[model samples]
Target: MESMEPGTVRPGGRTARVRTAVLQAAGDILAERGYSHLDLADIARRAGVGKTTVYRRWGTVTGLVADLLADMAEQSLPRTETGSLLGDLKANARLVQRTLADSRQGPLFKAVIAAATGEARTAEALRHFYDVRVDEWAPCVQQAIDRGEVPEGTDTHEVIRAVSAPLYYRLLAGGGRIDVAAADRAAEAAATAARAGVFLSEGRPR
Candidate 1:
C-alpha cells in the first residue's frame, strides 16, 4: 500500500487505525524515555506497523511528537460548568494539577516541555496544544462576564491561563507541592483577579 504523506489528516478507516497505533506508540516511548530516545523504527516495531508507514506519515520524530500533541489537544476534556466562575475555575485547576501530578503524565509533560525548550518546532506545537486548551476553557470566563460575576472587557483567555499558570509553575519548578490547596488557591486568585478587572483589555483594574 502507498504510504500517506507527513502531516496529512487521516480521520477514519484503516489510515486512522494506523495513525492511532503509531501515535500511541510514540506517546508510550515519549512517556517512558522522553523525546531524545524516540526512534521511528522503534516506534514502528512497538506499534506493530511498518517503519515506512510511520516514516512516510510523520517524516521525523519531531513531526510525530507534534502530531501527538495535536491529538492530545483534540482529545482534551471539555470545560466543566459549575454555575460560578470560581467553581468552574477550581475544576479547571484541579484537572491541571491532577494531570501534572500523575506519575506518567507528569514525566511525559516534563519531557515534552524540556524538548520544547531546545527545539523550535516542538515549542510551536506545544504552544498550539495550550492554545487549544485555553480556547476550550475561555468560554467559561465569558459566561462569567455575561453573569456580571466578572467585569466586561476582560480577556477570557488570559483569565483561563491565570487559573492554570501557577499549577504549571509548581509542576515545572518542583520547588513546591501541587496539592488540592494549591489548586484551590490558583483558581481563587484567578477568579478574584477577573472580578477585579485585572484581566481587562487595558491589563489593569479600573
Candidate 2:
C-alpha cells in the first residue's frame, strides 16, 4: 500500500519476520556504529531482506530512524511501581541510569540524540518517544498527588523529567560515571523538589 512503512507490517509468518529482521538489523547498526552510517542497502544486506523492500518501505533515512525509535519505545519495559513517591522515583531513576550506562542502549540513545539535533523529523520523533515514556511514568506522580505526598497542581510529566534530567546532563556532558549513586541522588533531588512544590507549574520543571 502507498501508506505502508517499515513499522506497519501486519502480523503473519513472513511479514512479521521481515519487520523483525529489518528492525533488528537497524537497531544493531544504530547501536554499533550510530545513525550516520545507516544505509538502506546495508540494512537490507544485514537483515537479509531486499534493498527494494527497505527502500520502498522506509523511503528515507529519517523515516527509517523514526520507525526504529518507535520500535524501541514499543519494546521498552513497562514502568515499575513502588507505592511511595520516593520509592517510585528511585526506581525510575535507577532504570534511567542503567539504560544510559548500558553498552548497547547507551550508544544507541546517544546516536539517536545526536541525529535528532540536526534533523527536524528526527527531533520530532525523539520528542514523541519521550512523550510516550513520560506519559507512561506520569501515573506515579499522579498517585503521589492522590496520596497528598506532593503539592496540588504539580506537573506530572515534569516530575518524571526531573528524575531523568540529571542523568541526561551527565550523559551529554560526560561528567561522571552515571552510577547507581548518581541515580539515587537524582531521585532524591526530584522527590525533594517535588515535595517542595517546585514543579507546581503546568508542564514546567522548576
Candidate 3:
C-alpha cells in the first residue's frame, strides 16, 4: 500500500468532500482563532467528520497547515497578461494588495505567517506558496525582455518578488495601508528597477 502524505487531497467522491470540509474547517479556525487553537478533533467536529479520520489523514498541525498552503497555491488566480510589463506587474501587485487587505484573507495570512515563524514545516510550506505565485508571474518579465522593455537577463523572478515585497511588508511589518496606490507604486518601482538592470543576474553587465 502506498503511504499517502498528510493533507494530500484525493480526487473526487467521499474523499474529496472530506478533504474540502476539513480544510475549510481548518481555515476557519485559523482565521477566527489562530494556529494555537487548531485541533484536529475540533476541526473534525466543525467539518462534521470523525476525529479519527482527521487524525489519520493529517497527523499533526504542521502537516495540516502545509496541506492548507498547498491547497491555497492550487486555488490562486492565474496571472493576467496585459501586453506590457508595467501593466502586468500592476495587476500582480493589485492582486496581492487586495488579498492582504481582505477582511478574512488578511487575518488568515497573518495567523499563518506567525505560525511559520516558529515552525519549520509551516515556513517551508509558506515558501512554497510564494514560489508557486512567483512562478506564475515571472513570465511577464521575460515577455518584457523579449519586447525590449526590461534589460536582457533581468532576473525575472526577482522582479516579480520586488513587486510583492512592499505589499507583504505592509501586511506584516509596516502596518500601513495596502491600497491600490501602494500596489501601483510597487509595480512602478519594480518596473523601473528592472529597466535599469537592478535585477540583473550575476555576470550580466549593467
Candidate 4:
C-alpha cells in the first residue's frame, strides 16, 4: 500500500489510514535503526512521505514518539471483565504478553526503552504510554473493588501497573521468559497484592 503524508487527510476524511501508516513506519525505523539514527528525513523517505510534511505534523523526534505512543494507546486491547480480579488480571497479562511477544512491537519497545534512557522527551513519551494503559486497565480494578474482591480505597492504578511490571521486567531486563506461566504469575502476584492491601490508602500499612 502506498503510504500517505503525515498530515494528509483521506478523501473519505478518515485519519486512520494516515495515522496507521505513519506509526507503522515509525515503528519500523525504531526497530531497525534504534533511536540515535532516527531522523525525520529518513523516516519520511522510508514512509514515502515528504520530509516537510512529517516535520510539519510531528515537529521533533519527541513529538513523533509521543504521537506514536498515543496511536498505540488507541489501539491497545480493551479491558476484559471476567467477574474476578484474577480473571481480569490474567486477561490483562495475556494482552501484555501478546503485545511484547509480537516480532515488531517487541523490538520497537526495546528501542523505545533504550531511547528513553538518554532522552528526556522519549522518557516522557514512554511515561505517557504507561499512563494511558494504566487508565485503560484501572476500570478492571475498580470492578474488582465493586465486587468486594479488593479493599475499598485500593489504588487501582497501582494494582494495574503491578500486573504489567514484571512482564515488562522480563522483556526489558531479560529476567525470565515472557510466557503464559509468567503471565499467570504476574496476575497472581497483583491479585495477592491487592488482597493484602498493598495498594491501599497512604496511611494504611501493608
Q: How does each model score on TM-score?
A: 0.90, 0.90, 0.93, 0.88
The 0-to-1 C-alpha lDDT of every candidate, in the order given, reads 0.84, 0.83, 0.88, 0.79
Indicate the TM-score of model 3.
0.93
Worst 10 residues of 3 by lDDT: 1-10
Question: What TM-score does candidate 2 reach?
Answer: 0.90
Off by over 4 Å in 1: 1-12, 203-205
Alpha carbon deviation, residue 110, candidate 1 (Å): 0.9
Q: For residues 28-106, could you state the per-residue lDDT of candidate 4 as single tens digits?
A: 8887777777888888887777788888989998889878876676556668888899999998888888777767677
Per-residue C-alpha lDDT of model 1 across residues 29-99, encoded as one tens digit per residue: 77789889999999999989999988998999899989988887877777889999999999898888877
Candidate 2 residues 87-170, lDDT tens each? 999988888888888776777788889999999999988888888788888999999999999988899989999998889888
Descending-lDDT candidate ranking:
3, 1, 2, 4
Best by lDDT: 3
User: In candidate 1, how many clashes are counted?
Assistant: 0
Q: Which residue pairs show backbone clashes in model 3?
A: none
Global fold similarity of model 1 (TM-score): 0.90
On the 0 to 100 scale, the lDDT of residue 90 in model 3 is 96
Model 3 residue runs over 4 Å out of place are 1-11
